[model samples]
Target: MALPTFTQRYEAGDAWLANSCAHPTLVQDVWAADMLAPIPSGEEWLVAEARLATGYPKLVRIRAEQRGPVLADPVMDALWWLVPLGAAEELADVRQLVVQAAGWCLNCPPTGWQVEGRMWITRPDGSGLLTDPAVLAAAFGPGGYRLATEASR
Candidate 1:
């Protein structure tokens, strides 16, 4: 299926941002990569962003389940927002939103990725911090932003 327009996707709300606290450093790094150029014809690009405990962004591309044409390498599959080509202007706005959402998520405490139905914060050495119910509650309780589920989409 063709991806939704940038405005539609943005208006649909950020499921990843609503569910997890992305690391600020990582967000900055993704923004810094300046990968928002025009996508070549017949070439599809996937951009994924995550928040890490470490104050640095790691841009390693990994294998991901096929969604579109398999690009050279896939980035993180969880807690990631995909930006397609021809959305340069929207891309800038989305980056800012992601950064802001990461800030909000960070404020909630114990920031991390929500994967496999669990919330996990990562440590510098690639270890996951034990899940804290309190943190989870604060981040995803009543009045919290509800991430858009696939069914809803």
Candidate 2:
């Protein structure tokens, strides 16, 4: 079979949320503004779908099913009410905790998977402390693969 396109993943994730039949909240609206973006065509949609599939909520239950106990984050308890059974396996415990503690900072509704912190969004990749490639190289590492020495701080 052909590999599923990004829109397919996004639509799938969207269906998962829609199947839950939960109403969007004020927080969700704001978070959505910060968190979600239009699919921007096929490739972007696929990127988003992949992120959602591997992110906190998705990773949580998936870990629970394949690995063990879901770490149990308070935030997830709130978010879980909105998720469908189909995507339950992907949620990660720690990620839920982060979302619980910091997810609110998201400027948009939760739509796609994200791999960075809220600060990363507020500041963005090519601005503020993240402006310099060397700074990023040191903070995150070479080719964004390694962390830097203490002097960087």
Candidate 3:
């Protein structure tokens, strides 16, 4: 269940501006370190898939059974979205679309991995956001953005 389209997702409130007011300063800080890069002109911007995930509930997990860079503390903050009624059940579907779309944008095949108690059933290599509701649900827990290193198994 890939997202119908970026347009469709946004229209349905699934597209949150990467730097919108809805995101807290902490979230922005985390996003900056974990998911954004600077354009040639020196302006910073969230990666394409990250931009998409901002509006939609998504996750981005790096798998390969190896940890890469050390994520800065502020960069690991969690951003949680409220799930309105009738939308809770669609978590898996939303995640699938987000994952597929991200994989396409990143020019890679979908890769699945487990994290904590939940599973990052779909993911990419470099940096991208997963859009499934279930993934989001797990990622943004009571505290938010559980460290990949400390995420439950």
User: Of 1 and 2, which scores higher on TM-score?
Assistant: 2
lDDT of 2 by residue, 85-146 (tens): 22222333222222122112222223343422311111111111111222211222222223
* Residue 109 lDDT (model 2): 29
Candidate 1 accuracy as lDDT: 0.26
Q: Mark the regions of model 2 whose C-alpha exceeds 4 Å error after superposition.
A: 24-32, 35-111, 115-153
- Model 3 agreement with the true structure over 53-146: per-residue lDDT tens digits: 3423323442323221111111223222222223334543443222221111111111221222221122222332323344444544444445
- Candidate 2 to truth, TM: 0.25
TM-score of each: 0.20, 0.25, 0.19
10 residues in a row with least lDDT, candidate 2? 121-130
Each prediction's number of clashing residue pairs = 3, 26, 9
lDDT of each: 0.26, 0.26, 0.29
Model 3 alpha-carbon drift over 4 Å, by segment: 1-130, 143-147
